[model samples]
Target: MKKTILLLSVLFLLISCGKAKNKAILQGKVENEQIAIVSKIPGKIVQLLVKEGDFVKKGDTLAILDIPEVDAKKSQAEGAVISAKAQYSMAVKGATENQLKQLEAKKMGLKEQYEFAKKSINRLSNMLKDSLVSQQTFDETFAKYQGAQAQYNAVLAEIDEARKGARIEQQTMALGQQDRAYGALQEVETANKERYVIAPQDMSIETITLNLGELALPGYTLFNGYISNSTYFRFTIPESQLSSLKKGQEISVGIPNSDKKIKGKITIIKQLGAYGNIATAYPDYELQESLFELRISPLDLDEAKDLITKTTVTLSL
Candidate 1:
């Protein structure tokens, strides 16, 4: 009778242990999609439109930067554009009426000089033939006539060029310069618009890294927060028990100290590195086993929107 009682007690203890192990619960944390809002240009924070914990929507103005450099650059660009436009106009149009008149007057003066030099050279040639003038005198007069003739021809050519427009190649080059200047102006304008930092998406602001009047560098994150309607559950399970869960499987997660349960689908099951931290303080599996991360997305995102991030949640295997 004594032996039989001992055997019954042992059997009861064994059964209880098996039941406790089968009902093991895994602890996970609630997480949300996060983002960092950064600046593309360096500037000082002149005005902060939003504060921490403020909810913002897409296209909303979050902050305003005072970029004095942008203003100066814009002025310079405008000047460049005006200068380029004038050059382009000059190339397309011929010389002005005043300029043509000046060229014509100069041509008339050169023509008179050319005629006088021609007469002088003819007289000197005759004198040289009659031995009245030296050969040096005749040569000097000939040279003066040649110079006057060249000057008259050059002025005529200049007047003709003024009548017609600039060469096609010159016009093309001027147009290219004008385009380059315009492009620079556009670039400066785009940078000027960056002074108003706008929100890219709807989100809740968790942190403000800079204060008013602080300098924000390029690519520096000014705000950090979670995206709206992006709550999910994260769990770390050892490889020994990985077979119990699969991607796309539906599961129910429980909130600690609350009766509310969330229905979610396993979206990802990825292996974690050896140095990665496990969510649960005491994992059930052996230490030698590899760890894996399980991400479960809620069926109804609205239901999980109010869930606090990094809060403890429970899941049964």
Candidate 2:
């Protein structure tokens, strides 16, 4: 009976253990920071500043492109700024007195001719009223008077426009065109700076895909650099056992066959990709499927630097 009792207890513990959950371990690559230097515009790579394994700091120039066209556009933009300023100055300073004098003289000459034509037309009209002038002569004089009046009015309008000074509206439009051209030039300069690739931050230069004199196209990738200081673990997980792990939960990581474990905090779990269904053992839980990536930072992981890029480790339950 004692033997039978022991067997019953052992079966009880085994059955209870079957109800517990275990998360499966998934493998993932370790990456901290990767800065990819890509071509901003299509052009031949005129200069390559750093080699593979070269160290770089933030904003350090690495590569350059051969784009004379970009340079030319920048020069044209500078010219536009100067042109706008000149126009602005001219508009502020009104036409000179000498200019006004010449306009007045022209207007007076037109007025004198107009007055003479008006008197001739009126005299002929009176003659027509009394049957003294022929219809043809009266008509000709009337036409001449109309032409003179039109000429006088045109002269008066010109003189008035000059006295009014240069129009601010016209000047504003001209200045705006110049400003837009300059703005386009600034954009080209920004793209040109990228031609000389700069380090986004202090990083370990990883790979150099091309050497000097390579024809680089827009969006062509040349190098991959990783940040030197920031380190984190990447975990790949299967569809099943994902729910067993949650962000903010503490995890135990240990070397293979070792009893010592280091604590790590889970930071991110991907909601997409491979996934598993909720435990069917619980009748009330909804069934869902998805894949995920887990990220964690180790506690007191100063020694983690040496173990970084480690291939073997187990996730403890």
> What overall lDDT goes with each candidate model?
0.90, 0.69
The lDDT, on a scale of 0 to 1, for candidate 2 is 0.69
Number of backbone-clashing residue pairs for each candidate, in the order shown: 0, 8
Q: For residues 14-122, what per-residue lDDT tens digits would candidate 1 score against the true structure?
A: 9889756744788889999999999999999999999999999999999999999999989999999999988888778878889888998899899999999999998
Per-residue CA lDDT of model 2 for 25-95, tens digit only, reads 33343436466878777666778778877778888887877777777877877777677666655555555
Which regions of candidate 2 deviate over 4 angstroms? 1-29, 94-164, 235-246, 255-262, 269-294, 300-302, 306-317
Output the number of the TM-score-best candidate.
1
Itemize residue pairs with steric clashes in candidate 2: 33-226, 63-196, 239-275, 239-276, 274-290, 274-291, 275-290, 275-291
Our tally of clashes for model 1 stands at 0
TM-score to true structure, per model: 0.85, 0.58
